[model samples]
Target: MLAGKYSTLGAMPTERTFAMIKPDGVRRGLTAEILRRIELKGYRTVGLKLYQIPRETAESHYGEHSAKPFFGELVDFITSGPVVAIALEGENAIAGWRSMMGATNPANAAPGTIRGDFATSVGENVTHGSDSPESAQRELALFFAEGELLK
Candidate 1:
């Protein structure tokens, strides 16, 4: 019975990705539901934490946007409250998480997506997922140490 259930383990290539429930999403109490949806998608949670983002870390996290005029706002908003940081492992996890998160703007996000159902605007768009494997590696390392994640 157990082996049968595990038969599909190698059916698809597995990858790791990072995801974050931004401050607005955490404040709105959507953490549990968001995690539920992720698990339902067959991804395994390797690491999870809820904590306030330090200013320095937030800045580093958004380093690519440092020259943007709205960069300060991005830092401020992310550091305003507690956020959920998660490391997930599954088949094509990077792309899978992004698809599940939907468009950057909730207004255009399709229904049934996390942002589509929970976000009200681009500024408060509920979630963040790594856009590629390299990005996933960088972001995951920033939020979680090597020994901190489950194997």
Candidate 2:
């Protein structure tokens, strides 16, 4: 379910997207800067945690990429260190967070975006954002359990 905000009139529905500061980003101490950008853009952080991802969880999370040649590398990188998983709520959060994350390949990302500024390579790209609403819901469920999210 989408996260909702209460207004004077009634409940105003808002989108919830999943975002992660990859091991590289966290190791580089970019977590605060990245989170600041999200909050500065007016997204609410409903849930957050820094934890080492288990192999099974990572496999499920990246299940769609199972057939790809780089799948094992992707899983290995993600589980290499602690990552910060966050649940963000806002209007058009899925797209919004993606925009903030910049291009998947840091070489191609623009100067002002997170990846552009922090990442040096595609394999070590510093963040992850849900590409669509459906993915957001599934991702959020994967990282957070019931009652973990704030109202």
Candidate 3:
């Protein structure tokens, strides 16, 4: 199990978020650093796995971006390499993960953030994070099943 900083109780019941270390991040050998940050931020890694998603799965995962011109490219990029999928748990985990991820475009991310620290290009941004509670729930469901993420 991954180490985490957290309290037993809080304003929000223990929440969950889905996070991914994208291909570029893994290729750059930043997985441990990224996981360290997540742990240091108080989110427990309830579930973790390294897997290469098939093209169809990648397409379905990013289906919200299907209308965008970069949809095909996005799918290709994601399916081209193995990714680290994580289910994080803690109070406000969804929001916490997003703040840690910074902006979608590394150039727009603030200094000291994960993207700002390691990413150079928007398309090769190092990570993926759930944008909202609804998104977190939906994404978690897609990546993890019941009993997959433990307390």
Candidate 4:
């Protein structure tokens, strides 16, 4: 379900999207900076956590890429360290976060975006965001238990 606090503009429904600060972001101590940007964008953080990703969970999370040769590497790197999982609610959150994160590869990202500012490579890009409403629901479910996020 779409979730968020009401906007002052009157009943403008906001959507919930799942976002992540990858291991590199956490290790580099960019969590606060990243979160600050999120809040500045007017997105409400419904839930947040800091933890390590389990192997099985990582596999499940990247299941769609299982057939790709890089799947195993993806799972390994993500599970190697702690990550920050965030549930954000805002107008066009899915698209907004993606834009804010910039391109998957830092090389092609805009100068003001997160990846562009911090990432040096595509494999260890700083952040992750749900690409669509359906993916948002699935991802949010994987990381959060029912009622865990403020509504």
C-alpha RMSD of each candidate structure in angstroms? 3.1, 5.1, 5.3, 4.8
Candidate 4: clashing pairs of residues: none
Candidate 2 C-alpha lDDT tens digits along 1-151: 2344434345345799999999999999999999999999999999999989999999999999999999999999999999999999987788888998999999889999999999989999999999988899999999999999999
* Clash tally, candidates in order: 0, 0, 0, 0
Residues 1-151, candidate 3: write the lDDT tens digits: 2334443334676788899999999989999999999989888999998978888778888999999999999999998899999999888887778889888888889887899899889899999988887888888887777888886
Clashes of 4: 0
Give candidate 4's TM-score. Answer: 0.92
Reference-based TM-score, model 3: 0.89
Candidate models: Cα lDDT each? 0.94, 0.93, 0.88, 0.94
Q: Least accurate stretch of 10 residues (summed lDDT) in model 3?
A: 1-10
Which portions of model 3 show Cα errors greater than 4 Å? 1-10
Q: Which stretches in model 4 have alpha-carbon errors above 4 Å?
A: 1-13
Clashing pairs in 1: none
lDDT tens digits by residue: candidate 4, 51-108: 7989998999999999999999999999989999999999889999999999999999
